[model samples]
Target chain A: GIQVEQSPPDLILQEGANSTLRCNFSDSVNNLQWFHQNPWGQLINLFYIPSGTKQNGRLSATTVATERYSLLYISSSQTTDSGVYFCAVARGSQGNLIFGKGTKLSVKP
Target chain B: DAGVTQSPTHLIKTRGQQVTLRCSPKSGHDTVSWYQQALGQGPQFIFQYYEEEERQRGNFPDRFSGHQFPNYSSELNVNALLLGDSALYLCASSSRQVGYGYTFGSGTRLTVV
Candidate 1:
C-alpha cells in the first residue's frame, strides 16, 4: 500500500490570491488525480495528471512521477474555490486509489 | 448527458442492520467505483467494477460487497453495519481510458444510530 501525504492541512486565502497545494506519495503510481469536494459533498475531478502538467481555468496541476509528488495551483482564487482539495493515486494493478487527507482551502470574499 | 447518479441522497440506519446503495454511471461509461468519505477526511476507495465483474477492491472487509450490472450500473451492499460505517458514500464512473477522468456522484450520506 502507498502512503499519500498532503501539506498545509489548512489554508486561508483572500479573494484573487494564489496558493499552491502539494501531495507526496511513498511509491510509484500509475494513476493520479486531483479532486475538489465542495461544501455540499460533491466530489469533482479537477485533474487526472499522472505526469507532466495540466491547466484548467485558474487551476493547474503538475505531477513529477519520478519524485512521487504532485502539486495543485490555484490562481485568482474565488469564494467558489473554497473546499477540500484532495490528491489520490493508484499504485499498481489493484487500481484502487490511496488519497491524501487533503488541504482545506477557504477563500474569503 | 447525465453524470453519475446515486440513489437516496441520504439515509439513516440502525446498528446491526443492512443497507443498500445504488449508482448509475455516466453515459458511455463502463466502469463504476465506490468510495467512502468521512467527515473532514478524503474519499477512500472501496472497490471498482468493470465488465460486470469486481476488478479490484480496497482494504474493506467482506461485509462491504458490491455488484455491477451488465448495463454498468452498480450497487453497494453493507451487511451488519456498525456505527463506524456511517459516512458519505460516493460513486464514480470512468471509461476504459486512463486519460478519461472519473465523474463522481454527489454521494449518499448514511448515518447509523
Candidate 2:
C-alpha cells in the first residue's frame, strides 16, 4: 500500500490571496487526481494530472511523478473555493486509489 | 445528462443490521467504484465493479460487499454494521478506457446507532 500525505492540514486565506497545497506519495503511481469536497459534501474533480501541469481557470496543478509529489495552486482565491482538497493516487497494478488526508482551505470573503 | 446518482441521501441503522446503498453510473460509463469518507477525512476506496463483476477492492472486509447490474448500476451491501461503519458513502463512475476520470455522486451519509 502507498501512503499519501498532504501538507498544511489546514489553511485560511483572504478572498484575493494565493495558496499552494502539496501532496507527497510514498511510491510510484500510475494515476493522480485532485478533488475538492465542498461544504455540502460534494466531491468535485479538480484535475487528473498524472504528470506535467494542468490549469483549470484559477486553479492549477503540477505532478512530478519522478519525485513522487504533486502541487495544487489556487490563485486569487474565491469564497466558493473554500473546501477540503484531496489528492488521490493509484499505484501501479492497482485500481484502488490511496487518498491523502486533505488540506482544508477556507477562503474568507 | 446525469452524473453519478446515489440513492437514500441519508440513512440511519442500528447495530447488527444490514443496509444497502445503490448507485447509477453516469451515461456511457461502464465502471462503478465505491468509497467511504468519514468526517474531515478523504474518501477511501472500497471496491470497483466492471461488467457486473468485482474487478478491484481496497482493504475493506468481506462484510462490505457489492454487486453491479448489467446496465452498470451498482449496490453496496454492508452486513452486521457497527457504529464505526457510519460514514459518508460515495459512488464514482468512469469509462473503461485509460485516461478517463471519475464522476462522483452526492454520496449517502449513513449513521449507525
Candidate 2 lDDT by residue in tens digits, A6-106: 99899999999999999999888888999999998999999988899999999999999999999999999999999899999886423677889999999
Model 1 earns a TM-score of: 0.96
- How would the docking of model 2 be graded? medium
| Cα lDDT of model 1 by residue, B1-113, tens digit | 99999999999999999999999999998899999998988888899999889998888999999999989999999999999999999999988854456789999999999
Off by over 4 Å in 1: A92-94
Pairs clashing in candidate 1? none
True contacts kept of 2: 0.67
Model 1 lDDT, residue B99, Cα: 42
Q: Taking the tens digit of each residue's C-alpha lDDT, what string does model 2 give over B1-113? A: 98999999999999999999999999998899999998877899999999899999888999999999999999999999999999999999988665457779999999999
Candidate 2: list runs displaced more than 4 Å. A92-94
Alpha carbon lDDT of residue A59, candidate 1? 92
lDDT of 1: 0.92
TM-score, chain B, predicted structure 1: 0.97
